[model samples]
Target: MAVLLHRLGLGAYRHRKLVLGIWLAVLAALVTCAGVFGGKLDDRFTVPGTESQRALDTLGRTLPEASGAGAQIVFTAPEGHHVTEARYTAAIAGAEAAAVKAPQVKAVMGPNVSGAVSADRSTAIVQVQYSVQRAEIRPSSLDVIERAAAAAEKNGLRTSVGGSAYGSNGVHIGPSEIIGVGVALLVLVVTFGSLLAAGMSLLPALLGVAVGLAGLLALTPAVSISSTAVTLALMLGLAVGIDYILFILSRHRRQLARGTDPQESIALATGTAGSAVVFAGSTVIIALAALSVIGIPFLTVMGLGAAGAVLVAVLAAITLLPALAGFAGTRLTPKSGGKQAQRSAAPDGSDGRATLGARWVRTVVAKPLLTVLAATGVLVALALPAADLRLALPDNGSAPVASAERKAYDTVSDEFGPGFNGPLLVLTETHDRPGAQAGAKAARELRDLKGIKAVLPPQPTHDSAQTVIQVMPETGPDSPRTARLVRDIRAAAPGIGEATGATVAVTGATAVNIDVSDRLSDSLLPFTAIVVGLSLILLTMVFRSLVIPLKAAVGFLLSVGASLGTVVALFQWGRLADILGLAHTGPVVSFLPVILIGVLFGLAMDYEVFLVSGMREEWVHTGAARASVTDGARHSVRVVTAAALIMFTVFAGFFPLDDALIKPIAFALAVGVAIDAFAVRLTLVPAVLALAGRHAWWLPAWLDRVLPDLDVEGTRLQKASRVVHREPERVS
Candidate 1:
């Protein structure tokens, strides 16, 4: 692998223009094609076999009009006035006029026309049914309805809109990317101390991110990826892209400072650091690919998109970075003669020198148990909030207060009831007259059930073989009470279905969220076990140690737990909700843990491989555990911390994104990377390795014989160094 990468780097350095041109061509092609063929991205996920999905399928086949997205134009009359008053009549009139102007609208049921009014007569709902699913409705198509709502508001009545269609406005790139880039530029310049070198590391990464996003957009027509997938891709792409470049660039500059020729330095760096880049990137790709095992389409697309971005970033690092390095010449080297300059140029603490990184390692090694205990205590304290962690889909309760959906939710909950915001549909399939009669009887009985606010009359389908009953619960969708209510309804469904000789399902927006929450919770254990197991196997192969992989796995879980617990405290428990502008305290996004586990686990392994591989290399060469620990930490600390800082910044930039879903993801990744870098990688890993001593490298003889040897650091580059030096023994 070292020889092959060395040769490739040599070729790229020799034909630098050609290599650069190929990347540029790829970028141009991606941009042009994606622009022409790109389709809109959305989150139109449905869990197969879930009651909500079953209800949708049945509706699509039997009552096609009912299958499309439904929007509620909620209206509230002025103080002490009823909706039937003439003052509110203009608002309804304007809405009716707008409905007539709107396209793809199947029907509109107004309060005056259909008598859909609240019990207080102060609130009324105008139900607009569209001809297509919410996923199929473009944001622009909903603007006509919005304009009508605005016109209605001009009257003496208060008006708001809510539904899946109103919920999805056009998604745009937020200021987070720009903010991330600005911060990255600062970190790169400070780290490299050379404008040309800093730009070299950053430019290729930005281009790779561009290509990745373009390719992802181009895939939208062929594959329906979630809209948020693009944001996630951008966040991850920038991070890995910059970090990959940082790895190779730092190594190349170190070789240049050692008086190696530019081309040779680039080759050796690519052969060594580039190999780690490949391994780390592959680990991330494998981890993300495991998301497919969950059997969720949106999640599969998200994983694929993120993995593809990482792949592009890796390719750019190995190919474009080396080619660009050829033009950098001596500018990659730090200036000589000053204290700061000397320290910056000292990549590996030469002349048996002890740098701060080395000093910290020694201090930790001196009292490994105490260091480990302190770090573990900090992580445990942060993770304590996770004991109360709750998971649910982000509903209107979590949406922006000014958003149409939130406003509509507030208006409806205040005027009609909170239950009116998310009504459950009780669907029953029957084959005989007695069955339909029994279904009606069951619907009437639902009114007497606890937590149910109202049970609408059962309406039979065209064939009279199916009956649909709307059941309104007392609580909102995000409430724990709502989830309990759903469970109660489902439990009672079996007995009712049996008595009616029919199949009954609890299906609605709230029901779908419950189903998703249950699936994510159930799948969390198996999914985590699989990812952790795979990471263990991979780390074991690279480090050639049982104890090493076990420790790394524990550290990874600790970082993940601490990060999630922080999210729970801030977002779920609302410890600082008012300051963050959160609408209310509620469950974390249902899929957040699943997404965080995949991303954070992969990122954790990235640091693990980079740090441990260096230590393992030192241990192999010197046969001294403490010296290797100190040496490796001193050598890799700057690069890993810099990489972590860049990643944290990139993720933090996403805070400007208005989407409730994207914010939690951004927070999790940013906090996770911070904890992993500072607490786990720097503090816990060294301490644990120091205490483990020789056992850190211990693998059973038989296990070693059976396991394939994978040298991620390209140690065989020592032989290649001999060829470059023209001396067999002076390879180093």
Candidate 2:
């Protein structure tokens, strides 16, 4: 691999113009296609084979009205005022009439409808039923609904349009995203110390991200791409792109400072660092692509989208970065007597003054047992909050506080009851016509359920073989009690069927979300085992050490545990909510843990390979475990620290966005990267390696022979280079 990468890098560098032009042409083509072919991003969360999904699909086939998206135009009258007043009633009636006239609006129930007005008459909800699913509901249709509600707002009523159909799931790029890139550039500048070098490091990464994202968008017309998936792809692409380029660029500059030929340095850096990049990126790609095994469409899309972006970043790092280096020639070399030059000239890439990584590793090695205990204790303390972690799909109630959906959610909770926002549909299907009696019996049985707040009369379809009954729960949608109620309803379905001669199923927006959450929760354990097992095998292959891989896996778990705990504490438990700008806190996003494990596993392994490979290389060359640990720390610590900060900054940049879906995921990745890179890989890893001594690199001879040599550290390339240098070139 190293030899092939060396040849590829040399070819790209020698043909820099062609390489640069090829990337540019690819970028242009993708961007153009995206502009022409990109379609709307759907936010639909569908889990096939779930009971709720099956019921919903049946309704879509038999009774379209019940399966279509529903929106609520919640109106709240002023304090001490009543919506029963003639003017308020008239305005709400006007909105409902207008809503009915809107395209694709099948039905609009006004405040005059039974149970539509609050008991105190201070609030009313005008329900608008669309003839399409949430994803298919046109924006213009929603616009008409909002415009129609203007009359109610003028009548001294607070009007908020919200519901399943009003969800804002479009990917919007804001100042925060730009600021993240800016911060990443600042990190690059500081790390490289040369503006030209910094810009060069950032350019290839940006180009790679552009191509990746553009390609993803271009496929949106054919695929049901979601906003969350795009945001994740962008986030991962940018973070990894810059980090990959930085790794290779930093290595090239180090070699340049050592007075190596510019072309030779580029080849060597790409061959060595680029090899690690490929191995590290493969771990991430494999982990993400493994999402297919879960059999969830949206999650599979998210994982594959992110994996595609990372793959592009790796290609750009190995090919485009070296080509760009060829253009820069010797200019990237640090100036004589400069800080970088002086540091690079040292035996361990540090000047007379010891680097912080070196000093810290020395302190850690001096008390390996204590270091391990202290680090583990801190991680354990942070991980305690994970025990309290709750997972749920976000709903209107989880929207930004200032959003219309949240306002409507709050008003409905305050007036009509929280359960009104997420009513469960008890679907009853009979084998024959005139099944009204069975439907009525099913409704009667549902009313007797423990969590039942109210069971509406069954409304049979034209054939009378299917009946839809609305069952409102006592608690809110995201409430644990509501999840329990969903299970209770399903459990009671069999008894209801036996008593009424009708097959009953539970489905609604709320029930579907509950099913989605349950599916993700059930899949989490097996998915984690797969990821952890993959990590063990991959790390073993790269480092060729049983103990190191084991240590790396343990360190990964600690970082993941601590990261998840922090997310639970901040986002779920609402700890420091105000400081973090959280509008509301309840359950964490259902898929966050799965995503964190997959992404952070790859990244944790990235740092693990980069750090441990250096140690292994030094150990192989000198057979001095203790000295190798410190020497490796001194050599790679600066690049690793810079890379982690760049990744953290890029991810943290998305933390402040108003997007409920993107915000928590970004924060988790940011926190996870920081903890894994700094605390585990740098601090705990060195301590463990120092303590393990000669045994740290141990591998059984039989096992070693069985495992193919990956040569991620470029040992073969290093020996080949030495052989070439020993034999002088003959003029032909």
Candidate 3:
């Protein structure tokens, strides 16, 4: 393929020129297409699900009955007595005036501000509703909410504003993208040392993001993505961009040091490193594609967006990066002897460590059975924690500075109830025509529910087919009481709505997450079966042996599990939580395992294919399984490590987001890359392959006879590509 590419020179560089043109077209299209994702649509609007989803939907209808935009706020103090007459009037008056001045706020109903103080009188609950439009998100509404929430917080009062649309959006997903990008870029700047290079390293990121966003636009007609799309795009983009550029740049630097003419060097650097980049990129794509098995739209879209971005970014790295490197000249060349450079400047990139991995590979090829047992043991150990897993989505609200909003939420919970700010949406679907009668029954049932503090009157929805009921919980949104209430609601809802003959499915962020988990688990077999099964097929075709593909699948699973276990031990298990500032180890983001497996599966395949292909090539030549495994490991280990390190550095560097959404996924990915690169890809795999011997290829003669022969390395294309060198252009 490399020779074919070289022979086909893209007019200027022949095949190299072709790669350049491909990059130009892909990047331009990706950049231009990303704009199509542009629209007035906001993806963050939470879809309906388990509890809160039902609550929000139901509350939207109930809001009008209470009139005004139907809002509430609470204030708390440690004192045991009610406010003095003067203090009460002043606080109430202050709230009233603030409401009046706030635009789009028709009025502040209830709380009366003066009364509604808690039983202890230390806490004051103000239930205020607006006679305004429902503003899930509007700049005007945002401004009003921020100002009103801030102004309403008084000197002696601890205030919190709940039931405002603007407040929810601002708290949950705000400034997170800024923080994620800022943190990721900061790491790259430190790693690269040159601001220009650091900036250059971001090309893949920009490209990846651009491509992912473009893909979102392209895919929007088919799938409704989350409002968190941009954030998700940024995370995947940063990792792919950094890793893609890291590998290519490392190769370029190595080439420059070897004194290859700048242009010819460009060909070699891109051909070798670019091939690795392309392969790794394909692996990422496969992994993200694995998320298709997850029934949740959130994970599905994220997987698609991330995988698509990675796909484009990989193409960009090998094609476009080399095109640019063709112009970078000496800029890519490393300075002599950084501290580590002085220690070892060998071409093998090992910092001169003993080659235990290759030696083990040799031993394993001699004893394939022993290697299988060993790899299986390592995998079982890593997978055990996964068996005990549970899932939850916590508020985990850590602001830039602990803001008034969070404190206010706590204060309000103390005064009114736990669900003051968080409401659960109850969707009651009946075979009978939807009308007030069904709603009345739902309302009564809601009010009777144990945690139910209030049931706003049911209202008709845009669909008009379902009635929405908003039920407030007895505890704060994130408290255990709320979660328990959510579960109880689900259990009781079906029976409660039975008289109305309404079918109820509870859904909110919390319930949606629970549903998502249930759905994800349900789909696990099909998803796993698809990825694992497809991988075996790809390997079967690539290696032309049934035994080899199975072995590859086994090794890949071990590496992925062990990698996951390492992450679980550290992040989820509380080993390095504090050190990483991710002290919240609440069962990991509900969707992380799926994302991790998808990614790790692909990467494991990458190592497996690269190693297995090399061994197969040698085996075909030597007709000795043990020698083939040993020699293949010896020759391919360096390239694999270099490829793996580039990916590892890029992923590990982006670990500081610390968001509930990103922490587990990022940590899991980092561990997968590190362990795959170091342990499984290096030491364990080779040892096992060495141990498997001829018996690893177990297909009956009839099956072997029928299979098509295919080989990835040491083929005619490889031999031809190595033979040609385009004339080197003088360094620009």
Candidate 4:
């Protein structure tokens, strides 16, 4: 592996201009194609085979009106005025009439028709039903509704338009994202101590992200890409792109600072660090691509999209970074002074005055048990809040406070009830014409169920073979009570079916969200098992050690638990919500735990491989595990620290964005990176290694024989180089 990477790196370096040109051309073509052919991102969340989704699909065929996108234009009369009064009636009626004339609107139900008036009669809902799904509903259809609402506001009615049809599905890149890139650039400059090197590091990362994102968007014309997928891809692409470059470039500069030939150094660096990059990237890609096994379409897209981006990042790091380094030549070599020169002069890179990493590792090894217990204790304490963690998909109530959707959601909750925003559509499909009364009977049963706020009269289809019953829950869409109600209704399906001789299925935006959440929840444990099991196998193969991989997995879980606990506290419990700019709090996004496990597992392995490989490499040479832990950490800690910080800043930058979907995910990744890198990988890993001593690298002979030589530490390349150098000396 190292030899192949060495030749590839040398080839790229030799033909630097060609490599640069090819990459630029590819990026340009991808961007142009995306700009011309990319379709809009869809935010519609659907899970096939789930009861809610199956019901919705059935409705699409048997009763299109109920399956199509829905919207609500909530109108509030002036204080001391009722919407039913003659003065306010005209404006409400006018808005309803306009909504009826709107393009793609199949039906418009006013307060009088739908009985949607608030108890105070000061608020009313004009329900608009479109003849298309949310993704298919044109923006013009929503514009027409908004225009009517705006006109009605002139008559002293406060109006807001919102529903499944509203809200943006496009990924927004704001100043926060740019600021993240800027911070990453600063970290690179500081790490390399050269503006030229920093520019070289950031250039390839930017290009990789551009190419990856463009390619993703280009496929949108054929594939239904979600905004969350795009955001996740962007986040992973940029962070991994820079970190991968950092790994290879830092190795190259260190070799150059030690007076190695610049070209030879680039090749060796690529062979060594690039090998780790490939393995690390593969772990991430595998973890992400494993999302496919769950069989959820949107999640599959997200995982695959992010995996593709990481693949691009790995390619650019090995190919483009080395080519760019070829252009920079020996200038990337550190000056003959300061810590760089000092460390370069040392045979083990840990000789000179003790650096922070060296001192820290020595102290850790001095009292390994204490360090382990303390770090583990801190992580466990942080993870305590995870016990109370609840999972649910976001709704308009969780939207930005100033957004029209949020305003509408708030108004509906304040006036009518929170359930009005997320009423369940209970569909009763009768097998026989004699069972037409099943709809009425089902409605009665639903109303009698606990958590029932209001059950509208069932509306039968023209054929009377099916009926749509709107059942409102007492709580909001994101409420746990609402989720319980959904489950309760489904649990009663068998009873309802036997009594009415009809199949009962519940679906709506709210019910679908609940079903999606439940699906994700059920998949979490198995997905985690897969990721952890894969991590054990991959890390064992890479490190050729049993204890090391076990330690890495345990540390990864600690970081993940701590990160998730923090998210639950801040995002779910609303602790420090004001400081974080969170406008509302509810259950954590359903897919977050699964995403965190996959993403953080890969990232934790990244730190593990880079840091532990150094220790293993040192041990292989010196055969002293304790000294290897300290010395290896000394060599790798700086680069790993910078990489972790770069990742943290990049992920953290997205946290402050107004995107509810992206915010918690970004924050979780950021926190996970920080905790894993600083605490688990750097601190706990060294302690465990120290405690294990020589046993840390122990692998049964048969197990070792079974594992292929991955050469992640470039041991083969180093040995081959030594043999080549000795051959000339022997001849002399």
Candidate 5:
């Protein structure tokens, strides 16, 4: 494996111009194709075989108007004025006319006919129904609708639009990618101290992300994915890309400083760090692939898309980075006479006794018990809030306060009720018109329920075979208490429908949200267990250690738990809610657990591999576990911390996005990267390794023989290190 990687690196450098030109051509082709044929992304989540979906399908067939994407054109009258006033009425009419003129709009129902005028007559809602599916309606069409609604302001009326269509148009998914790249560039420059070096590291990452996004856009017709998928693909791609380049670049620079020729240095660097990159990238890919086990088509597409991008990033790191480094030559190293140059002068690492990291490791080894306990305690305390985590889909209540959707949500909640923003649709199949009366009785019964605020009268379908009732609850969509109301209604629905001789199902935005949340919640434990178990097995094979893999898994879980707790506190409990731009306090996003587990666990294992591989090499050569622990920690800390900082900066760049779904994701990943890299990898893992001593590397002979040689750090070059540099007890 090391030989193959070394050859690939050498080849990349030998034909550097060809490699660069090929990548350029690929990028050009991908961008050209994307501009001409790329499809727009949209959110179209649905869970088949669920009661909510059944109800939705029934409604779509019986009443086509309610089938397509929906939007509400909201109008507010002048202060202390009634919506029925001449000017306000004219404004409302004008807004409706504008909506009607939209080619995509199938119908515009409003005022008295739609029962949308507020009781106080100060506000009104005009329902705009589209003929096209939600994903089929482009943002430009929504822009036309927004402009039409804006005309109401000319008549002294304040108009705003809200719903899936408007909210979809509000998302700017690609800007965060640019911000992430900018931050990564800065981090690389500061870490490497050379513009050429930094560009070499960042260039491949940018190209990989661009190509990945272009491919994702082109794949949209065959594989359905949301706009959120775009953000995630770019985020993960940029992060992994930069880290991959950093790993190889750091090693290549170290070799150059050691007096090796540039070609041999690049090849050896690739053989070692490139091997780790391959294993780490595979772990990430496998973790993401686990999402396929959940059986959700859209999520599967999203996970695979991200995994594909990561694959590209890894490949680019091995090929494109080396080629660029070849071009960079001596400029990749720092100038003479500075601290870096002084270190470079000590090529054999024989200039001194110990580094700060080695000293810290020695101290921890002297009292491993205390260090391990203290680190464990800190992790446990930070993770406490995770036990009380609540999960739900972000609703209008969670949108940015400045958004039209959020304003509409606030206005409706203030005037009508929080529940008005997410009403439940009760659909029932009945034999005849007499069953409509029974449906009305069921609606009345719903009104008597504890959380019920209001239940509108039942209306029969055009064929008179089905009846639909809209029931408004007292709580908002994202309320922690809302799911209970859904549970209660489902519990009571059967008896009520049976008595009425009808078959009933609950469906709507609120019901779909509840169902999706429940499904995700149910799957979280098993899915997490699978991911952890798979990672543990992989680690066990790579490191040839029983205790090391177990300890690594525990440390990773600690980091993930603590990060989730931080998100729950910030996004769910509303701690720092105002500062974070969260419109309201509510449950965290339902899929956060699975997503966090996959991403954080993969990264945790990645660091463990990079750090431990160095220690494994030292131990194998010196036959002294304690010294190897100190030496490996000393050598790897700089690169590991730099990589972590780059990842943190890229993730943190997304904080200002203010997309409720993305903000928490960004926060969790950022916090997790910080904790995993600094706390778990730097402190806890080393302490545990120190305590375990030689036991940390113990693997049963039979199992060792059975397991595959992962070659995680390139055994060929690592063995060469011992023979080439024989200085005892060096600074590293």
Candidate 6:
């Protein structure tokens, strides 16, 4: 496959130009389509049975007649006062009027009187419940709530609205995109000094984003994809797309500098580096596909988006790129081979000689233990911050945004209702026995809750014949108070449901958040296991060594831990809140870890592949472990560093994105790449391999028989039939 792809220079000049043009045209067309459909991508996902579907089912069965999408809106003033009759009445009237005209809203019943207003007149809660008359009450739900706030403002009240839909909107997308891009670009710019090369590095990245978005947008009609999903796509696309391209470009650059004929270099690159690119791309693709097992509609969408991007990126890197490189020739590296570049004096120093990339291998064999400890310490230090990780959703409206508007939210809430900006959702379902009055008691009990301001009169579902109860609490959505309400309700549900012979499932803004946290916990173990296991298998295949695979896997984990710990310490547990642009550590975005693992594992392995592949290749020529380690690192240092920089730059770009989830993931990798590429893979991995020597390739005879051999050393394929024969050319 690689051989065929690398043959672009076989054609004449006109054909080469034509082929390049065709690829550009194809890219342009794909990107144009992607732009048209990219806006709808999102990250807000739902656990398969426990998310939207579950809530919908319970609602459908419970109130066949009472068909309205239930939503919560909290109102606030200040904390220490009594509410006069006039003020309370006016607030209620305004809230009611606002709800009536809001899109998707069926009715507005309350400022239902209660403690929901808080002991002081500082806060009040309003229940705005809606019937699904048009689209599902998702993103648009908050728009209507905002419009209602405008209405209430006209009357004399301040408002802070939070709901599942609204909170998703507020997640910080900036950090992820900005950080990811920033980090990736930083690496790329450093790797390839010319802006053009860096720009080229981004080509696959841009395409991945375009295709991932368009495909995800297309899926919205049939699947429940959340707004948060796009952030995942954006992050993954940048990381993989850029890194994959880096691998090919480095190999191509090497061949060009060696003065190989353009056609020969193209083939050798494709047959060698390009093959690794294919396998790496495939690994990421398969890993992403495994997310389908998560039982999460949102995660599945994210998986599909990432997997699609990887597939496209792999194709572009191997096929389109080789053709372009073949067309560019020496121009791509006119000055690269010069000594000023601090380039490795590969033995064949000038174009075609044997290179001394074998030196680093010899050094490692001399001092194995020192090498291993240094690498281990570096990784361990990085993982330290992970232990302090605080998993909480940031209340920057929803995710993380340093927007003035987002900041203004805190001031408004503090002045009016301390808890007004964050709130929780409560879902109530009842059983239909001859007499199941559990639903009624749940409603009455809801009205009596201390922090709640009003409980709407229980309305029988116009669609499901079940009952719907709406309660407004003093805290708005996204607040700890709201989270407490959700927990309290759950604690209370068992007794209430038993008494009524009914089932009550709490699902609202706060409830969903709690659910997300719970679900994340449930998902993390499996996510870790799968990613670690798969990465180990891939590594084992690459090196044919059990101990080495285990070591790499452990190193990967340490990197993950270090990154998380740093983020948590800065953003949550450690309280470097100012540096992180965090007002305070609220809950970390619920999905960050799962998404982080998905991305970080692949990136860590990238360096792993670079270091190990080179070392393994060296081993083929000379079986000395030390020789292989030193030689491999010496050879791989430039290319891997360049690739890592590009990745880091791309990650950093997302720092300006509005979402917070990206920051940790991107920053972790940004720091992690440095550690993995420079310390672990370059220094530690090689040293360890040196110590292990032949054991790095040791496998039980029986196991070896069962496992297939992986040959990453495609060097022999570099010589074509022409290069192979020194005899006089045969007449055609």
- Best by lDDT, which number? 4
* lDDT against true structure, model 6: 0.61
- Pairs that collide in candidate 1 are none
What local lDDT score does residue 329 receive in model 6, on the 0 to 100 scale?
63
lDDT tens digits, residues 229-309, model 2?
988999999999999899889888998998788898899888988899998899899988988788778899999999999
Local error of candidate 3 at residue 551 (angstroms): 3.3
Report clash pairs, candidate 4: none
Report lDDT (CA) for all predictions.
Answer: 0.82, 0.88, 0.58, 0.89, 0.81, 0.61
- Which residue runs of candidate 6 sit more than 4 Å off their true CA positions? 1-44, 51-56, 60-95, 110-116, 132-162, 165-199, 204-208, 340-345, 348-367, 381-436, 442-459, 463-465, 468-498, 719-732
* Cα distance off (Å), candidate 4, residue 732: 5.6
Candidate 4 global TM-score: 0.98
Instruction: Show the lowest summed lDDT stretch of 10 residues, model 1.
Output: 343-352
Instruction: For model 1, give the RMSD to the true fold.
Output: 2.5
What's the true lDDT of residue 465 in model 6?
Answer: 30
Give TM-scores for every candidate, taking all chains together and pairing residue i with residue i: 0.95, 0.98, 0.75, 0.98, 0.93, 0.82
In lDDT terms, how accurate is model 5?
A: 0.81
RMSD of 3: 6.5
Give the number of colliding residue pairs in candidate 6. Answer: 132
Candidate order (lDDT): 4, 2, 1, 5, 6, 3
lDDT (10s digit) by residue, model 5, range 1-732: 777898999999889999989988988888787678767676766777789977887777776555567788788888899888987787788778878878778788878676777789888988888755678886677886788778888888888888755564323555665777687788788766667878889888888888888888777666677877777887899899999999899888777766667887898889889988998998889888888788666667768888988999998999998898889887776666555545545642323556555566677777888998998898888899888888888777777788898888888888778888888888877765555777777887787778878887787766576778888889888775667888888899888877777777888878887888888888898988888798789999888999988998888888988898888788777788777666667788877788888888778888998888888878988889888887777777767888998899888888778677777888899999999988788888888988888999999999999999877888866677566665643745
Please give, for residues 1-732, the per-residue lDDT of candidate 4 as tens digits: 899999999999999999999999998999898989988887778888988899888777777878888899999988998888886889989998989888899889998999998998889999999868777887788889999999999998999989888866788799999999899999988887788889999999989999999999999999889999999999999999999999999888888877778888899999999999998999999999998888789999999999999999999999999899899998888777866656766776744688777788889889999999999999999999999989988888888999999999999999888988888999898875744588888887787799999999988765568899999889999999998998899899999888778889899788988988888888988988888888889888988899998998888889989999999999988999998789889899999998899899888988898999889888988999899999888888888999999999999999988888999999999999999999999899999999999999999999999998787878889788779767988999
Ranking by TM-score: 2, 4, 1, 5, 6, 3
State how far residue 508 of model 6 sits from its true place (Å): 3.1
